[model samples]
Target: MLLVVNIGNSNIRFGVFEGDECVNSWVMNTKPYKTEDELYSQFKIAFKNYDIDINRIKDIAVGSVVPHLTYPVRKSLQRLHNIKTTLVSKNTPTELTFMSPQMGTDLYANAYYAFKKYEGTKIVVDFGTALTLTCVDKNGEIKGVVIAPGVITSLKSLIGSTAQLSDIEMRTPKQTLGKDTEECMQSGVIFGFLSMVEGLIDRINKELKEETYVIATGGTGHIFAPLTSKIKIYDRLHTIKGLRELYITQKKEGLQ
Candidate 1:
């Protein structure tokens, strides 16, 4: 069994995988001041619900985008779980086209397994603290990716900079055209972000000369997938899934 963790800015996602199948998974906020004891106790309870033992997990794999939480997580695994874990690094084996050191750990994991499993040319759009557009060639190599402000980030900036613009919760807009202030803000942030994604994908297809399969994963992925045509929605836990797949691949090849 392998324990896979993907730590993002806002949340920490964890999964227990037996080979390629995920057995249990859960998520918690990425509080910067969280003590090792707090995290360990929470993880222990999460595991206990599914009758999973931290001791039984053979290999541990982690991918972290939050630098502050990484050390504590590593220490927790080392001290409490007694498992030597491998942090996904730039130098790790991947199919990306760029230099290893330049890629973010989040994009690295998603682009790797997405291209491998889906095949052909593909794009993985992650809607997190930022919107990440990662491209893969027909040969399943990470061609490149673009990162931009997230929907909420844009909203916050607009609200902060303007007096009339009021902050609103993220949700699907009732109609593209809004008649009120709240509705208008929702449209601009939500539908506007969808348009941005579609436009970028269109440009990538035109330049690359290949019809790429667009896979959406993140907290807001499901909300936006229906608003657009021909988009596929996968669980936001894709990065964690990819980490497990890569770990298994390395183990089978005697690379781990």
Candidate 2:
């Protein structure tokens, strides 16, 4: 079985894939200072509950945004289980040409695999630490990207900037016109972010001739997808799925 790990800003998500199917998955908070044993123990307990044998995990591939934990994760996997690890790099097997090849590793994997699965004009809006808009042109080239404050980031910033704005629970608001402070915050965050997402999709669609398939991902995408148009949420596992594809392709090509 292949282990696909996507280390993001907020969490580190892992997926155990047997062929194209993801049999099991888990996620933990992204803590840079956390020890390897702590992370591995957490993963062990999580996977053990699902009846996944940690010893059975042989090959592992990683796509990480948090650079601080790079070596530590690699070491943890190797030390804990003797699993062979591989990092998804720029030279990694992929069909799409990167726009800014060195900007971010996770974004590169997302765009590459998005191009591979869904052809033609597409946009991958990853709702992570930041809401990143990655555009893949009709010819399957990484055209450009737009990075905006993520839903949570924006919400946190709004609360931080304004003393009157109280912390509100993140959920669907009953109505657009909020009746109370909590509802008002929820409306602004959920509905307001929805409008921003739809607006971006609409504008992108207007500029292009081919119909663009917008794939929404990250921890909060599932919540936002229901309230928006032209946005499809494939859960947060898509990132790890993308990494797995690249790893399998590279293996087939005989590239380390």
Candidate 3:
């Protein structure tokens, strides 16, 4: 069994993969100040709840965007299972070439898997703490990326800044023209982002002069993916799957 962990700004995702199949997955809130012991306890509880044996985990792969939590997570895994984790980074051996050496490991993992699974021009739209679109071409070269405020990130900022506005459930509004305050916020945030995604894909397609495969992933992907035909695929486990694939590739190359 391979344990894959993706630590993002908002959440930390864990996947237990048996060969190419992911048997189980879990998500937890990201608390940067948590100690190694606390993290170990959390992992233990999650594994227990899922009936997964800690001893069965053969290897661990981690892709972390939050620098502060990386060491503690690695330490927790090491202490609990006596296993060293392979951290995914730009330096990790993969088929995709990154345009920026300093790009986030999570993004690199996303692109690595996308490049392997899909053909021709591909864009991975990840709606995490920060909304990101990573473009990779048929030749396995990363073209570029587009970054914007995430759906929930934007909503939180708006509520925090405004005097009267409060949080509302994120869903597609019944109409583009909102009838009430909650609907208004939902309309603006959800529909607004929907347009942004579509417009950007259109612009990117214009630049590429070819059809592009867009894969959506992350927490808010489910909310927006169903509302648009532009988004072809929505797999919440994309990042973790990528990390698992990266681990397999590294192990094959004797790098792990």
Candidate 4:
């Protein structure tokens, strides 16, 4: 069994993979101040509840965008299971070549998995705490990336900053013209982002002068993916799957 952990700014996800199949998964809030012991305890409870034996986990792969939580997570797994984790980073050996060394490991995983699974040029749009678009060419080289405020992030900011506005459930608005305040906010937030994404995809296609497969991932991918025909695929677990692939590659190359 392989355990893959993705620590993002908003959430930390754990995926248990048996060979190529992911058997189970879990998510927890990202608390940067959490100690190793606290993380170990959380892991123990989650594993027990899922009936997954800690001893059966052969290897662990971690990709963390949150710097403060990375060491604690790695140390927790080490202390709990006595297994050293393979942390995916920009330096990690993979078939994909990164354009910049500062790109997040999570983005690398997204691009690597997309490059391996799809043909031609691919653009990965991840809608997590931040909205990121990573472009990978057919030659397995990352071209560049675009980062913007995520759906929830933007919504929260708007609600937080405004004195008269309050939080509302995010959903697709029925029409471009909003009838009420909530609907107005929804239209501005959801449809606004939807247009932004579609426009970006179109712009990217124009810039490349070729077809590109756009894969959407992350927390709110499902919401926006179905609304837009531009998104070719939507897989929330894309990053963890990529982490699993990286782990396999590292093991094969004797790096792990």
Query: lDDT tens string, model 4, 48-73?
Result: 99999999998889989888899999
lDDT of candidates 1 onward, in order: 0.80, 0.80, 0.90, 0.90
Cα shift from native, residue 83, model 1 (Å) = 1.5
- lDDT by residue for model 2 (1-256), tens: 8888888888888899987899988888885568888877876677778898877788999878788888778788777678668887657866667657565777777777788778577788888889888888756678778789998889889999997997777899889998989998898889888888888888777777557888888888888878766786555776778788878878888876
List candidate 1 stretches off by more than 4 Å: 49-51, 162-166, 252-256
| Number of the top TM-score candidate | 3
Better model by TM-score: candidate 2 vs candidate 4: 4
Q: Once superposed on the true structure, which residue ranges of model 2 sit more than 4 Å away at CA?
A: none
Off by over 4 Å in 3: none
Compare candidates 2 and 3 on TM-score and give the better one.
3
Which of 1 and 4 is the better model by TM-score?
Answer: 4
lDDT of 2 at 113: 71
Please, what are the lDDT tens digits per residue for candidate 1 over residues 129-240? 7999888776766778989998767788999999788878787777989898888888888888999999999999888887888888877887888887747665667778
Model 3 residue 65 CA deviation (Å) reads 1.1
